[model samples]
Target: KFEQANGGTILLDEISEMDQGLQAKLLRVLQEQQVERVGGRKIINLDVRILATTNRKLEEYVAENKFREDLYYRLNVFPLQWLPLRERIADIVPLAQRLLAKYSRKMNRTAVSMSDEAQRVLQAHPWPGNVRELDNIIQRSLILQQGALIGPGDLHIQPGSMHTAEMAGRINSVGVSQADNSQLGNDMKQHEFQLIVDTLRETGGSRKDAADKLGISPRTLRYKLAKMREAGIDLDAELKG
Candidate 1:
């Protein structure tokens, strides 16, 4: 990959997960800006700009001796902290708009757009999975959308997942009360809650199978199940033995 990105850039995502052996090799490569192929006598030079990203705090990893300290400093040059998609509510709609156009062209759909209500829904979602999750939602919604405009009903997000920005947005735009907001939040979650329960039953209470069917991570499914448990929904009584 470094040889291929000779004059451009290479992104090493999830850098914190790299093993110690690989970290040593990467440190050497960064210092030398060169590489050699396995069981070969040829030395290849590189001019690639290295970019790395991690969802973890590297300093903590380094302090714990999980990551190399020298490599951490080497790669920390010009570092940028990316706020989560839920925090960057301002970027949500614009990013969605661009993604919509891109997907529309790829899918051979003509000039699809988002409705005002749909935009509001997009803004409201907590985006637990971040932009990748947002990408999934938009792509799925495009298929569900029947017309040029993507409406709130077309969106796949659980209705009850609320963000602070969403609450502010609602108050400013619709003059909705806190009480009304609570009701909307509660009602929206029922659909998602039921779907999960039904899927669990069909999978014979196998969460992994249900997660695979639902297109969510097992961890996410576990979290959802925890929420249901908190809501006093007794799933144990209903699941197949």
Candidate 2:
């Protein structure tokens, strides 16, 4: 195709999927304005502009010799790194609005707008899949709703870290591995136990409001308090009434 289309642009979607050998061949084409197609010796003179996208770090691959250094250099000529959606919360509302308009027409529904609380939750979310995930979520929300206003319940994104990579120990010291999860659960229990003890002191050992504030059932809180007592948590002395 290089011979047929001598002066054109090629979009290499997910270019990182190319092997090192193929990357080296691509580098040659980029440098010399020529191409030798697979299983063909005849070199074709071409003036093709290359546009590529990769989510992976090409330089890291080049350093590991997994990607050709020369190819990486050629592609890095006018590199543009897009910030992930999590970093650009400001774009969330506008992007969601756009998607709403687009899918509404496609699905033969009235255009929808997100509720203020919905927008707040959407903006607060860490969108790891970037625009693609947002698109899916909007589509799902639109289809699920009969009304024109989208609520926070419509956008079912969980209210925390959005990816396995994001959940792993980088910002939070709590790693997301199985062992780390066990430790995290234990730590959370300890923290909760301490908070309950303190709250009990403030309420003069009243369990009702403390259970309400903590968003747990009274029975559940009592069960936890009993467990804490068994573990030798000096609830009364810690409170020091």
Candidate 3:
């Protein structure tokens, strides 16, 4: 693979997780610039650029003798450390919006736009899981939300290190109430139903347009309308022109 990517880059993510034996092998490959395939006698020369990332402090690992000093030196020729999400507050909203757009297209949902309140909630998060966490939150919200606009109620943010008791108090001060675990399911269902109705109203009872706005399929909207009719919600009467 290195030979194939001779002029390109090979990224080794989470390099700290590599075992000592594998580290030694990697060091030999980097130093020698050649590799011998298993059961093959010919050694192939490599001209690939190597890039690696590690969440842990490699210097600490080196001091503890958990990582090979020689290998560390070879790989640490140029190092760039990324600040955690909590520290990079400016990036949170842009990153979230980008991910939202990506997952929206992938899931075949309408282009979901973020509400200012939702953006605030996202910005408040500490993001212990970093970009991966933001990605998951956007994906989950896209799945749960039933409106063109994603609001704070649509997000299910877990409390993190930065979300301390003081932060909770601050959130409450801003009129954002955290739901009790027991009531969360019912509350979410109510929100989803309301969002669906609002979208239908906005689109003048056009189910396809409403479904597009709600990030759901037209068939799904029909099924939901059917259920609402059975539940005496009278959506048809309400939506009639």
Candidate 4:
């Protein structure tokens, strides 16, 4: 398959989570530009460009012997670090607008725009989950929005209670009622839990399908469900329905 991708790019996302044996195999492939398939003797040449991404610090993994040092060096030839959304405040509105357009089209919803108040709320967000979180929020907001404009009320941005003091001040400046913000924060988790349950139902209890519809990985969905179970949420009963 790597050989078939000759003259193209192959992205290995979350490379740090890959198995150590697989890392050694990949290192060999990179060094030799060829791969031997399982149960096959012929070596197939590959001329594919490899791009890998990981949120973890590879150097730390190397120190812990969880990641191969040679593989890390090979993948780090041209490293690019993207700042979290909270730090790139200037990009928030533009990214939000782009995402809104994208997901609206995807969901067959009206081409909607964000209200000034909603934009302010987004800019004030701590964005602990970064771009992916923002994307999910936008998609959810689109589903909840009734009009052509998405208001702050439509957003289900979770972990809202963890907002910075500056963000709280900004929310206040936007004339968002404290009661409303507090209620939203309180309802956020239940809303997310319900969303997951509904997606699972829609996908007939298939975790992979539900994750695909929710724009998240099955591993992420499993981890979230595990946390919910740890918190005493009755997932088994909810999922059975």
Candidate 5:
């Protein structure tokens, strides 16, 4: 009965992780101001306002059976999706400067500024991990930096930064080879020649039986034997009646 008497708000962070059973239970509490604890007889009265936040797309997860549909709709009443850092390049330099100042104060250091080249590097690099990754990189650069200004060398980011997924895509996009492909054709021919020799051996050098086992006419089998002989593959000796 806290919200009933005194106005207050409850924040549910990482709300996508909430279970279906809990979501159902929470739905009841949201619609009705009655709280029935687990295995409790009396329904405790409470007035609570919820503000749920999640980094994941709860609607997609709900569609995929990973999240509860009812709960997703309930919390998505007024949702605001923040844009990634890459989409807002203008803010990067200002953000970096603010971060630099914050780190400088925290570390009891001063005059730790980004050089022009370092600013260019930061602006070009695609921050996949977004603000968190940028914060970490700045922290690392601040720790490594000895001089007053931090250059691209201090940041340690190349001109065109590559993410793990991009690298993996490049690796997986490779096609089949021509040398091995050509060798495969030769291997198939050799396998067929070996099959004829083995089938003849199993049939005690009987061409008629060998032809039947190979699912080929006796005429075709005779032609194949001639080819094997020409290729220096001793089919009769290999067959060994």
Candidate 6:
């Protein structure tokens, strides 16, 4: 792949899936910017850019000794963590429209637009399967669609599916009181917000440690903090109190 993409970019998709042996070779190639062609040792010296993606946590994999620590550091030059679709509610309609156009072109259909109600429906769903789920649903809607607008009926999704009680976690570990727990029972969002606050305080405001305790990425924790602030939760005040 490096030889094929000489002077260009090559993506190592799901890099964590590469075993130790392959990881060693890849690390050498990335470090030297060169490769030896199989069955022909001409010592191909090439310039290439490397990009990688993975769903699993590579840091955890390194700690578990499943992934090469050196390779993890080499590929950790730039990391980007994208929030799940449900968290990116504002992007739903635009992404759907883009996908609709893409699939329409492939299907040889005229331009199609989602109805206002249909847009609302897409945004309302939890989207547990994320963008791939959205992609499949849009394709199905395109096929079942009538006229040029994909209406509410054209779309299909199981209601109340894959949502684990608004992703509620064990609040007992946070050390909240019985009275606060009673109020938390009434409001799930507030419960989650308070949980994060308590965890941060327990970690002495170390976001990384708090994220590790909460079993979420630090970037996700940052997003939650942003949401809490947007909801008018005074983080400083909460931390002090």
Give the Cα lDDT of each candidate: 0.72, 0.68, 0.71, 0.72, 0.66, 0.74
TM-score, each model?
0.64, 0.55, 0.63, 0.65, 0.51, 0.62
Q: Candidate 3: which stretches are off by over 4 Å? A: 161-241
Please, what are the lDDT tens digits per residue for candidate 4 over residues 8-102? Answer: 99989999999988999999999999988889999888889888999899999999999999999988999999888899999999999998888
Candidate 1, residues 33-54, lDDT tens digits: the string is 8999889988899999988999
What value of lDDT does candidate 5 attain over all alpha carbons?
A: 0.66
lDDT of 5 by residue, 60-164 (tens): 898899887766777778888878999999999999999889867765678788889999988988888677667756765664354689988766554344332
Put down candidate 2 lDDT per residue, 104-138, tens digits, no spaces: 77656775688999999888887767787777677
Best-matching candidate per TM-score = 4
Q: Candidate 3 residues 1-241, lDDT tens each?
A: 6767777899898999999999999999999999998899999989899999999999999999999999999999989988998899899999989988886776566758999999999888878777767775676576567579988866667566422221212111211122232432443343444555656767787889876655557898888777555555556655552
lDDT of 6 by residue, 45-137 (tens): 988878898889999999999999988999998899999999999999999999899877765668688899999999999887788778767
Q: List the residue pairs that clash in candidate 6.
A: none
Q: Tell me the RMSD of model 2 versus the true structure.
A: 14.4
Can you list the residue pairs that collide in candidate 4?
Answer: none
Pairs of colliding residues, candidate 3: none
Ten-residue segment with the worst summed lDDT in candidate 6? 163-172
